[model samples]
Target chain A: MPTPTSSEASGPLAVETVGLTRAYDTLIAVADVNISIPKGSVFGLLGPNGAGKTTTIKMLTTLLHPSQGQARVAGFDVVRQAAQVRQYIGYVPQMLSADADLSGYENLLIFSKLYRIPAGERQQRIEETLSFMGLSEVARTLVRHYSGGMIRRLEIAQSLLHHPQVLFLDEPPWVLTRRLAMPSRNTCGPCGSAGGLRSFSPPITWRRPRSCVRLWLSCIKAGW
Target chain B: MGQTLAVAEAEVRKLRHDPVELLTRAIQPTLWLLVFGQVMSQLRGISSDGVSYRDFLAPGILAQSVMFIAIFYGISVIWERDSGVLYKYMVSPAPRWALVVGKALGSEVRSLTQASVIWILSALIGVHLRLELGAILGMLVLALLGSAIFVTLSLIIACLVKTRERFMGIGQLLTMPLFFASNAIYPISLMPAWLRVVAHINPLTYLVDGLRTLMLTGGSSAFGLGLDFAVLGLSTLLLVVIAARLYPTILT
Candidate 1:
């Protein structure tokens, strides 16, 4: 295995995978993937739909065994010291994996207890998690009734409940559109003001107004 | 310890939301008790040491229910793997033992509930319990110990198998053989000479015999009790070690 670079060695690394690979029979889902994520950094894994990002994340999180090489999360080996590695990280899968039959509060409480948050702190932690996720009112409601966004938010909340040093989020941005849209609106508001207004009007008028309308139609056809 | 409790708590919470699944879990066993027991009682030439067919069938069906419940241990693990919940648990701070224990305990608790329901129905159908309190306690202990072994075996299978369809296919294929090969439905002597040898080797045969001895014989023989307990204890420990070693490989 290659040694960590000086910069990497100096910084606190949250996750590190060296030559990680996963194969199913003949097909390789994840090829040699080596990445170092810094502590507390909100890293985004960008790739096309099937670029093996989920597979890579699965190996790093100790969910799937690597066919080759090794990984460390929060300084613990993913293979040799998996239980220790699990101690410092939280994982939110791409799909909603919470028990649909369980109440939101019950789900949080179960995970909090599983993580071994002390008995004295469990009630407070569960309440705080529910409040943080904006699920306090409906905490008693079954998760099957929760909307997709609510389920996603609750899942994120569950990951944070353990106060993990590292969090593996498979598709955080797609589920966090509200947060992503805020910064972009502020930065690009002035530059696209005229175009935005013109684009907005065509939808209301339901009329194609030549060049700009063609662009709107094309974008719509692509299903952006 | 905490992780096991958490997973068990989560499973319990799931039950609260979908109590029907709990009912569904009991349904198959109940059918065996009600329909199959009645049908088997009428079957010719199925006698066990002068006991009525219902008496013999009760313990067999009980063991069978316990076995069926244990098989879900692997099925649930595969479901978690496919659906990604296993990943969540794998990366959590929960100890591996906690995960294994929690799942096993959860299944045990579910099976016990089903067992209790069946026991009540058995009582209603005139299945008598002649044993004193000591035998009742022995029966409970044996059921719990036997469940641990079966659950561990289920986990080993689950950790080794990746796909749901394959797991189910193999699980179903093994269920009847494991049941029949044991001294569950008929006494070991009644089985074919070869099958009698196979039944003697089956860990489940000891469990069923232990349960029957406690329930029917009323815990009279110290030697029988000791041998039964020893067999069950040893098997539980061996299967658990195998499960623990295999678990990390699967999760990794």
Candidate 2:
């Protein structure tokens, strides 16, 4: 029930959900939730399974309608201005949304076309995205052949295809551990010979408006 | 529009990754045509018109194929919702209508592919094709519009249900009834009075009737074509509006 603070009012908020509530019959999935996410930031909606993180993200992104209240993304109302809102955000859902029958590059091409990236620039963008995710080599391979980690990476790459102004990461607690367990751990060069080094990289990095980050960090630390 | 297209493109690409799935989706209808159509022909009194059973069965199978292809349209949405891809679409800047349109169009594209293959196979099996450019174009339009209606129906169902089991259960419950209730399996005149009423109301009946006219009669009757087009067009418009309205609400 936290309101958007004065500091967050200074810039364009990437996502704002006020009094958002979703109910099915008598079951309340997400109730009276309020949040504000700033532009250009990676916003993590973290909670236990079925904690309404996914539902909340859906409302903010215009996937699900709120039973009460409103959600706006990138300065557009998710309900009233949904098309404009969708044009500005990138969404990567908890499950693998990519077509397993398609090759990596083919998948990217489809998204490029959907996002209406200029026809002229689509090829370059596809190539760049594939390479960025280290998927260029496997670009021709069917996604079904992709490893679990590779699938997640490809999902991330697809979300960034259009360079969405706000990114929502609905990280279920279990998936977080698995994603963090990947070999993103880098050792200091000087300590390489010592066969050990502290894990310098945080398990996850969320980038959002400075004020929202502070509030988000505090919430995470509080174990909400 | 752009983002919806992107999601659709992704959906199409995913199809390539699973060749077996694509093969099954494409080949199942052909098998039905080859086996079921041939078997059903052996039954006495199956044909009301002078048309041979194979000829009579061809357009019906085509309509069925369109229905089958579209039935899975929302399967992707359900899978995406479970996998968080629906969440991605929800959060992205793409318009809700684009998402609906893109998914519908994507399903139409797949349906068209399967329908074309069936058309080719029918020709090989000696089922006559009118091959008039106008007829072919008309068939494609009908198929696309019909596919869009079915796909939208699937999306609405997907949005309403949360689990895959429930989605599949509801989908199965709806599809076959829809097929049987229509003129897809038999002519409306042959159906019982009560069932005939259902077929008259079933949108698929108009689609099948239109396709049959195009394939068999070489062109639809002016009245028949007008009724078919009007029903399909009106249904598509209503479904699109319902889908657009339900889309954002469902996300929450």
Candidate 3:
């Protein structure tokens, strides 16, 4: 266990993983991969389905523990300092994480409580997040009534409620486009053009050309 | 503590959206109390302990209602997992136990509502109750403890099975046996020797026994309210620890 120095604390690296490997019995999902994401940089991971992109996201987000090796997110080791890592990082998984039964506002409010946001600040912050995600119009509407893109935006909004330093987006371009476009357009600096926006998507390959369709679109439309 | 409440509040918000489900849940216990208790109360053989059959059945029905409400809670975990809500909680800064406890607290709230319904139903059906504040509060506490125990058990099953089908199958399999095998439908003394052994070991037996003692008569019954509550409290505490420990395995 290495102690992080003051300089490393303020370093440009938002995420760094060295020799990070996750094996499920005989199969190694992510094998000895190393990558460093600089702060304030928007980096995309391109891999085919089952190519360990989600696995990498899981490890970095502290949702899945790495089998062997070292990984740090937001200056904290994901394995040893998972709570601290969670505090500084946000994750929007491939699937919709917000409760469908809850209104978009309720979902964000619940997350605010889980993150222990101050009572005085919670309502204002939730309003700000909803507005930032362009969801204020339907904040009171149940998430089940939300559109696919709206649900994705609500999830991203909830993750940003606590204002984490690093954000991990696991999925293809539509979510990525929303992730990149909405915040930059509305809030001006949160998850959009701001620091620590990492997106994961399936790789671009001739064998499976359809998977990267959104990838190309996001890069073109969102200007990523 | 705030995290626990947050998790519980989330569940409450969901429940609030589906308030009709709670009413639908009341139908089962309503049938048991109104129909089953009425029919069974007339039978002399089942009331050999000198207590009216309705009185005996009232507490049992309360316990059964809580069991029915809680024993299926695991299916929600699978739903949450599939819907990605569980993953969100897992990645949060909240401790795993806080999440589990929050879930249990959520179930506790449901069970509390169920208890109130049962109490009113029992009174309407002419089943005598202590009706005292202490008795009501005691029963509420026991209902919460009982609910926590079964909800934790459900969570354990959810963690182990990881799918709605298996969880529902196992949950259905466990609930009936747990209900009939316990003193919920019958006194342990009326059971055969083998069943008496099982009933003594079953946590529901303790819950039912506690409810019976607290609701039917003023003081303790043959099963001893002290022992009943002790077993339930200890078992709930133990299961909470086990459930929290098993909770993370569901993600893998």
Give candidate 3's error at residue B161 in angstroms: 0.6
lDDT per residue as tens, model 3, B1-252: 999999999888888888898899999998988887778777778742557887788888899999888999988988999988888899889999999999999988888898899898888877778978998889888999899999999999999999999988998899899999988877888899999899889999899888887887633476787898899999988988999899988987
TM-score of each: 0.81, 0.75, 0.89
Question: Across residues A1-224, which tens digit of lDDT does each residue of candidate 3 receive?
Answer: 12233354644577889999999999999999898876655566655567888888888888888999999877789898999888776777778788999999999888888888889989998998788677999999999998888998888788777766676777644554545443222222222332333432322111112211111111111233
Per residue, candidate 1 scores C-alpha lDDT tens digits across A106-171 of 778888877777778878878877775678999989988998888877887787676665666665
After superposing candidate 2 on the true structure, give the runs of residues whose Cα lies further than 4 Å from its correct spot. Answer: A1-85, A91-99, A129-132, A172-224, B1-7, B26-36, B39-44, B217-223, B248-252
True contacts kept of 1: 0.83
Worst 10 residues of 2 chain B by lDDT: B214-223
How would you encode candidate 1's per-residue C-alpha lDDT over B138-212 as one tens digit per residue? 777888888888888888887887677878887898788889898777777677888877877777788787777
Comparing 1 and 3 on DockQ, the stronger one:
3
Provide the lowest-lDDT 10-residue window in model 1 chain A: A211-220
lDDT of 2 by residue, A91-127 (tens): 6665677657677877677667666778888788788
- Per-residue lDDT tens digits of candidate 2, residues B90-164? 555456688788788777768888788888888888887788899889889999889989999888887788567
User: Could you tell me the TM-score of candidate 3?
Assistant: 0.89
Q: How do these models rank on lDDT, best leading? A: 3, 1, 2
Q: lDDT at A9 for candidate 3?
A: 61
* lDDT score, candidate 1, position B73: 66
The segments of candidate 1 whose C-alpha lies over 4 angstroms from its true place after superposition are A1-11, A16-34, A65-70, A179-224, B34-44, B217-223, B248-252
